[model samples]
Structure formats: structure tokens, C-alpha cells
Target: MVSSERLADIGYKTFSGTMTLYGGYLCSLRVYRYFHHREQLRIAAENQTEDIIKD
Candidate 1:
């Protein structure tokens, strides 16, 4: 049987670890948004070029 203090300590560690993982997920989401935005811009530019050629 674990003592009360040990259970509290384990809970704290788990909380901190979960927070760290959440931070990393946020960072990756930002990066993904940036790349997604860039790709969209590239596609728009290509479409514009096609329009110009047609005109």
C-alpha cells in the first residue's frame, strides 16, 4: 500500500508531465498552421498564374 505522501508526489509528477506534453502539442500545432498557410498561398499563386495565361 502506498503512503499518502507518495500518492501526492506521484500525482504531482503526472500533472507536470501532462503539462509538458500539452505544451509540445501546442508548438507543433502552430508549426502545422504555418506550413498549411504557406501551402495555401502557393496554390493561390499558381491559380493566379493560370488566370493570367488564359487572359
Candidate 2:
């Protein structure tokens, strides 16, 4: 049989589940933007390095 603490824990889990999902989604978006920005910087650096080498 489920005890009172178990029931309360389940309730907390349910509430936190929604928060966790939303937090995860926002975190993923931030990570995606960070990676995209880093990729652009990497490409720009490579181009600059090549230009310097050619000069």
C-alpha cells in the first residue's frame, strides 16, 4: 500500500515534471543558439587564418 509520504512524493513529482520539461526546452534552445554562434565564430576564424597564411 502507498503511504502518505509516497503520495506526497508522487504529487511533487507530477508538479516538477512540468517544470522540468519547460526548463529542458528552454535549456535546449539556449544550447542550440550557443552552438550556432560558436560555429559561426569557428568559420570566421578559419577564414581569417587562411587569409593570413595566403598573405
Candidate 3:
């Protein structure tokens, strides 16, 4: 049988691990979004340059 202290320890570790994983997920998403936006801006710039050259 688990003691109260043991249960509290398990709960704390579980919460900490969950938060760590969630933090990593958020960071990964941020990086993906940043690159996606950068790519879109680059494409827009290329299109604009092409239009200017055509004109």
C-alpha cells in the first residue's frame, strides 16, 4: 500500500513530466509556424520581384 507521501510524490512527478512534454510541444509548434511564415514571405517577395521585372 502506498503512503500519503508516496502518492504526493507520484503526483508531483506526473505533473512535472506532463508540463515538460507540453512545453516541448509548444516550442516545436512555434518553430514550425515561424518557418512556415518565413517561407510564405519569401514566396511573396519573389512574386513581387517577378512582377516588377515584367513591368
Candidate 1 ranges beyond 4 A from true positions:
1-4
Question: Candidate 2's residue-wise lDDT over 3-52, tens digit each?
Answer: 99999999999999999999999999999999999999999999999999
Prediction RMSDs, each to the true structure: 1.4, 4.4, 0.5
Score residue 38 of candidate 1 by CA lDDT: 100
TM-score, structure 3 vs. true: 0.96
TM-score per candidate: 0.79, 0.59, 0.96
Clashes of 2: 0
**Model 2 ranges off by over 4 Å:** 1-16
Give the C-alpha lDDT of model 1.
Answer: 1.00
Q: What is the C-alpha lDDT of each candidate?
A: 1.00, 0.99, 1.00
Q: What lDDT tens digits, residue by residue, belong to model 3 across residues 33-55?
A: 99999999999999999999999
Error of 3 at 34 (Å): 0.4
For each of the candidates, give the backbone clash count: 0, 0, 0
| Model 3 / residue 10 / CA error / Å | 0.4
